[model samples]
Target: MQTTNNTVLITGGSTGIGLAIAEVLIKAGNEVIICGRRESKLLEAKQKFPQLHTRVCDVAQKSAREELYQWATSEFPHINMLFNNAGIQKEIDFLTGASGLYDEESEIETNLVATIHLSALFIPHFLQQQKECAVANVTSGLAFIPLKIVPVYCATKAGLHSFSISLRSQLAKTNVRVFEIAPPIVKTELHREAQARKQSQRGIAAPAVAEATIRALKNNHYETIIGEANVLKGASRIAPKFFHNLLNKVATG
Candidate 1:
């Protein structure tokens, strides 16, 4: 995929990894449009980078997803790249049963379902474009190895990883390219809940993930595993039980 001169739409672009990506893409000369749930956050992002086209839409809702797609494609008809980067992470203790699952945002809806729906909406448009187009799904290293505390978040990413693989195979012969970007725990607001619980929030910077993602796009790497995520992916395949225990141990410790 050509890195420059492409129109891109990134979901959850108001902050964190999404904003970092928008920054990189804009600097690289791509027209970037970003959407998020909060209008104030979008305004802040717009103030920081005046070039970004900002919209407020929650990707967790099916109607919002459809509206975003229609608006993006209609307003920016040249948009060829879609980055499903909007996501939320929550720590749910199953010991509490159904009470832990009653959140305003569903991890399955925002992280997995939104990606599937947006990809389905844009793939046909991308196929009809004369140039190469791409869809990059921002999954997590947790997708490979389950993190016990955030069960739902990990499950959604795992589902997304599987979907990206299938989507890539399906689009292999077409003009659309499917990419999966898996980053290890990054220092982003996604860890707000964990931070509130006094958990360590140390990890790679969001820019590292953003830079890795651009490199993956430029090099056409279908699956780009960033940082310690590579270890999780390798260990999951090589020594599943040991690493699984090691991972949860570190988290609980």
Candidate 2:
């Protein structure tokens, strides 16, 4: 990746990790477009970073995803980078799960299916680009070690990791680059309250993950893992049983 002078699209770019990535890319002199479901959040992000292009679209909607693809290709013809960073984390217990109001449908629809759909929509367009083009899949360390509380969320990420590997291999002869970013628990609103409940445990700063992303792209490291994420990824590879036990302990307590 050239790292600058190109256009980038980041999903869920209003706050937390997405906002952090948007800031880093914008500062690096790249044309950046950020999309979120809420217009207010998008406006808030733009207020903070005046140069960021904001789009109000929810990736989980099929029509909106199609429109996003069309708008990007037509308006930002030079766009060459995509960061699939939108996701939702829900605490669910299948034991007492079926409630009248709460459901896990959105978690799967928003986090997993939308990603697959958006990637399929953009892959061909990315291949036709004349410059360095890349599609990044933001997964998690929990993909390697399931946090039993958020069972569906963890499963979706693990499944995405598998899909990314195959997607990369299929696009090996093409101009597009496929990347998987496995991040550890990051200091973001996604799990801030739960983490706060336990003072001894904490997450990596979103800034650290954002900066590491820049470095990873610079070095062309496709499967990027940082900090304690590396430990989880390594443990999944080296000691699966141990990792599972540790994750179980965390979830229970």
Candidate-wise lDDT, in order: 0.92, 0.85
- Residue pairs clashing in model 2 are none
Encode model 2's per-residue lDDT on 47-67: one tens digit a residue.
999999999988878899999
Worst 10 residues of 2 by lDDT: 97-106
Model 1 has an lDDT value of 0.92
Question: What TM-score number comes out for model 2?
Answer: 0.94
lDDT of 2 at 45: 95
Q: Which residue segments of model 2 deviate by more than 4 Å?
A: 100-105, 199-201
The top-ranked prediction according to TM-score is 1
* TM-scores of all predicted structures: 0.97, 0.94
Q: Which ranges of candidate 1 are over 4 A from the true structure?
A: 197-200
Clash count of each predicted structure: 0, 0
Native-to-model Cα distance after best TM-score fit, residue 178 in candidate 1, in Å:
0.6
